[model samples]
Target: MFKKEITAGAKSKVKSSVQRGIRTKVVETYPLLAPHIDEIIPKKSQLDLLKLPDRVSLYALNNEPLFWQHMDDAIVPHLRVVHQFPHCFSRIGIDRGAIRFVLSGAALMVPGLTSAGGQLPEPEGQLKEGDVAVIMAEGKEEACMVGQLKMGTEDMKEKKKGVAIDGGHCLGDGLWKMSID
Candidate 1:
């Protein structure tokens, strides 16, 4: 949704109760992050809440951004944040050809993911639709996007051609470029 660069409009310290709620939500959404919760968000450290345009809320520790949620949707980790815990989420690799489109903020199509260079979720993994996944592009060391699946792995294989993932935070996109301080 954030196609253009955005600046944090106002900043405020998050209350303990609200911070607890956020922590709960984060753990629920990303169970792998449970063990490192303290490292990511220390109990004694102050968490800053930045209010951005279009009702997007960014949660940051000190000057480092951790995650952001659009409206009341699921929280999406910042690309930089995701880079710190690469194995925490399911991943889908896009072919090099589709890298440009993803960076341009386009919804990822099925072909971009099912092509030879692309890698789909393992069949045994049983990824369901709406599951959050990190988008990695061929030759890239870090994830390029963080989004939700539009279709299940089986359906993506059967259909072969259609939008595969909903747009969320992408490399070089507004969210990725947003400054917290």
Candidate 2:
């Protein structure tokens, strides 16, 4: 994985977008973003959000988000991925940066060998509903939900105020007491 430095202003914008569950436009003028459009965008639905010509990732959420409650243990070596959803997703092994691609309706997210270093030679596993995917970066082990996508602190703050009115989701694990706002 390539590491790049982001300016404070850009970071703030990204944070604001993620916090608001809004998509930010990638600025094509940035020197570092011209080569990775395809990698950052894998789906047609995400194309419109790329209007700025820069790569963008999710920044935030507005609704009660749902994640797999017990997804940490399913990791395995050379596991075959079977798709089970309409969207494309990946089950990435953290330590090796091996990525398994799946279309909807494929079986559990699993890994397959490829010659592209870490990239999958061919997409396997069709995506489908109720499918759980784990993504990890290179040189990393042990997966947790970590993506550049995030929400803005302002949105989180607003959501926190709604908690008293019974409308916010839990921000932390154990006792759904904390809200993101």
Candidate 3:
């Protein structure tokens, strides 16, 4: 599915444009950050994002949690793998809609739970043995799930000796959730 489809100059221009867009969007969304936006730009650089080594890079982006509570259902934001590892798992907590490729492993996500069903949907279908499991976001005190996910255990573990992710089961929507990062 991957193929060369763009020229070097075009690629460079597109990359620069996207970087500027991210900077502008972040600054506008967080006005309080207007003062030091310049300094943050270099750190938030997305250059060679497609060339970065296989791994999930977590950035607080100024000590402020990068995760946001998405409420606009009409807006479905697509999250391509800007960076990732082969067997690595990404523990993403999306308050909004998200989509990613199943790169060998699975992606674990648990949204806030409101009630029994809450905002999240229950697991369904016959999940394959090594099939990637994605736990959608739900309300705070209602989401309940228990399943065996290869990546969860790795994502939860403090450090993986030979593994790249910690595999484990998650209960309620905690402040911080683990993933195959």
Candidate 4:
């Protein structure tokens, strides 16, 4: 949603109850996040909520963005969060050639993910549509973007064309450029 560089909004401390709720929701949506829940959203740590354009809500810890949600859509982790705990999220990789496009904030295409250099979850359909995914580039150690799947991995393997993910938060996007602190 953050297609352009946007300025920071006021940061407010989230209530303890709300923090607990967010923690619960995150863990529920991403069960793999359970093990690191305490570290990601420590019970004692205060969380900051920042309002961004297009009805997005960003949750940060000590000025480091942990997660963001659009309207009432499923909450997705920030790229920083994905980098901090890479294995905790479902990830797909694009070929080296697609790295620049992804970094520039273009929506992911199936070919970029189905190519020889790309990597998708094994057995296909392991990751379904509407699920949030981390986009890693070939040979890269960290993810370059995070976005919800427009089509299931199974569908992508079948169609081998069309968009894979839309509205992804990428490495150099406005969200990444925004200085939370």
Q: What is each predicted model's overall lDDT from 0 to 1? A: 0.86, 0.23, 0.29, 0.90
Candidate 2 wrongly placed segments (more than 4 Å): 10-90, 94-112, 115-141, 144-181
Candidate 3, 121: how far from true, in Å? 32
lDDT of 4 by residue, 8-86 (tens): 7888999999999999999999999999999999889999999998889999999888899989988999988898899
Candidate 1 Cα outliers beyond 4 Å, as residue runs: none
Q: Please say which candidate is ahead in lDDT: 1 or 4.
A: 4
lDDT, candidate 3, 1-181, per-residue tens: 0011211111121266756755666555445445655654564454332111122222233332232212211110112111111112212222323212112123333222222332322233233333333344333222122223333332323222222112322231121232212
Residue pairs with backbone atoms closer than 3 Å in model 1 (clashes) = none
Best to worst by lDDT, what's the order?
4, 1, 3, 2
Measured by TM-score, the strongest candidate is 4
By TM-score, rank the candidates, best first: 4, 1, 3, 2
For residues 39-107, what per-residue lDDT tens digits would candidate 2 score against the true structure? 333223221111011232212122112111112221111111111111233433222432221111112
Worst 10 residues of 4 by lDDT: 120-129
Cand. 3 TM to true fold: 0.23
Instruction: Put down candidate 1 lDDT per residue, 148-174, tens digits, no spaces.
Output: 787887788778999888767888988
By TM-score, is 3 or 4 better? 4
Among the numbered candidates, top lDDT falls to 4
